[model samples]
Target: MAKKEVLRLENVSFSYAGKKEKAVDGTSLVFREGEFAGIIGAVGSGKSTLLYCCNGLVPKEIRGKFAGTVRLFGKDVAKIGFPEISREASMVFQDPNDQIFNLTVEEEVAFGLLNRGMAREEALAAARKAVARVGLSEKLHDDPSELSAGQKQKVAIACALAADSKIILLDEPVSSLDWRSSQEVYAILSGLAHEGKTVIATEQDTCLLSRHATRIIVIDGGKVVKDGGVEVLSSSLIEKLGLRPPGPMSCGARK
Candidate 1:
């Protein structure tokens, strides 16, 4: 029997406002529950655009013309209410600072839960749980402005988890972090996947993808050129697809 798909994109295409060509063109893919999927591409390859469509942020926040279908958890994203979508899919952007608006760490984590109609006490408890899960329990009362970039990203992840979302769309989650922090974030993301959440991340670091992702989808010029398990994509093909090969350690010490 085939595995159940948590996300499905069927012949989807998107064009931003004032743009002549589509940012994402005729893309079709499936992301199953408990899968860790990575998207690798060169700059301007429409990786982010594809993620936006998955989380229903494309036609909602972006001024764009969308054609075709995107379904999340068996419901059409285009037809799902924004609030409902928020409950099912949460997104963390490339920049943690862009997503951190609340003054305190706790506030940031609780924002989504509150918006979802969770009572104050329940929301606070959930926030605490999420913070603890991300190893940010000690920073709950800290000012969001005072934390390091990586800590801020952890808070952002905590906030996403507070919503109890089934699908997470992370855009370049580790691009801005230091090596140690990047590993920390990867560990957290790995744990989420282990808990049966679908994780889809767009990354420039193919090494990290190879190390942590169950599958990698290579995109170029707004289309998917390759999609397969890490071992199935050759180093040469990764380079030809405009993606770098995994680091030596990631590739079993091979360069």
Candidate 2:
């Protein structure tokens, strides 16, 4: 039997306000539950635009004109209520600072829960659990501004996990982290997938994706150029797409 589809994009096209061309065009794909998928491309290849469409954040929040269908868990994203969508999909941007607004780490994670009607105590408990999961228990009371870039990113991940979202959309999640921090983030994402949640990340780091993603979709100029398991991607194709090959660790050998 085939696995169930958790996300579907059909003939989806999106263009920013007054732009002449679509950032993402006629892209069709499906992401299954509990799978880890990565999208890779050059800087202008529309990977970020594709990520925004998965959770109904494109035309709705970004003021773009969209043509096509975006469905999350079998429901049309455009038609779903914002609050309802938030319950199922959570998005973390490249920069954790963009998402962190609360004063402290605990409050930052709990804020989403409280807004969704969870009681304060319940929200705090969830926040603590999430913090501990990301190994940030020691920094719960510290101001988000005071944490290292990596720590702040962990808090952002905790916030997403605390919401209990089934599908998480990450936009270049490790682009801003150091090598060690990037590895740590990947480990956390790996754990999330093992726990039966779907993770979709847009990244330029093919190395991390090769090591951590179950599958990879190569996007170029707003279209999918390749969709397959990492082992199937050729080095020539990686170069043609302007993507770097996986790091030594990702390829299972020491550098």
Candidate 3:
């Protein structure tokens, strides 16, 4: 059977207010369910804007000039609206502090559920399961600000899972973490993908992207230059694009 497409961007382009250049220029891509996709690109390459467009944050909330079509689950995102799209797709920003504002970890995860009309007891129960998925069951009552950066990111993921989101979009999830911490977070995300969640994330670490991502997408100047499996990381195209080699290749592993 053919894979089901979860998100589709057809000839999509976006320009921010007062900006002459389009942040996302004629980008077209399709994301399938059960795939862990990594979007990699240089600074200002429009990877972030593309991610926002996946969940209707662009044009709808960000106030940009958007063209072309962005469809999530066969429904036009522009027509369905943010609240409807948000129920199926959740975005985690680079900074966990921005998302985790509640006093406790449980509160942090359950807040979304409560807002969506879930009962308090039921929301807490669901939050417990989500926290356990991220291996944070013991820290359920801990202050989010006191947790390490990586731990905080995990909490953000737990919030997404708690909300029963099918598609999770993350922007530069490990941009500020140490190597060990970054791996820990990716492992959790990988686990989520294994459990049938569509994990789409942007990352600068080619090594992690090569080893963790099931599909790698190289976006440059708001266009998808390459879309393939992990083997793409082993290709010479990395140098042509001015990207560092995959960690294994840099460490003398065979191409």
Best by TM-score: 2
- Residues 27-134, model 2: lDDT tens digits: 999988889899988998999999999999898898878999999888999898778898999989999988898988999999989988999999999999999999
Candidate 1: list runs displaced more than 4 Å: 250-255
**Model 2: lDDT of residue 68:** 96
Q: After superposition, how far is residue 249 of candidate 1 from its true place, in Å?
A: 3.8
lDDT by residue for model 1 over 1-255, one digit each (tens)? Answer: 566688999998999999989889999999998889999888899999999999888988898888889998889998888889988899999988888888889988999888878899999999999999989899999898789999988898888888889898899998889888888888788888989898899998876776788888988878898889887355587777666677665545311
TM-score for every candidate vs. truth? 0.95, 0.96, 0.94
Give me the displacement of residue 254 in model 2, in angstroms: 11
Q: Order of all candidates by lDDT, from best down to worst?
A: 2, 3, 1
| Candidates in descending TM-score order | 2, 1, 3
TM-score of 3: 0.94
Candidates in order have lDDT scores of 0.86, 0.89, 0.87
Please report the candidate that would top lDDT against the real structure.
Answer: 2
For model 3, how many clashes? 0
* Residue 94 in candidate 2, Cα distance off native in Å: 0.6
As a TM-score, model 1 comes out at 0.95
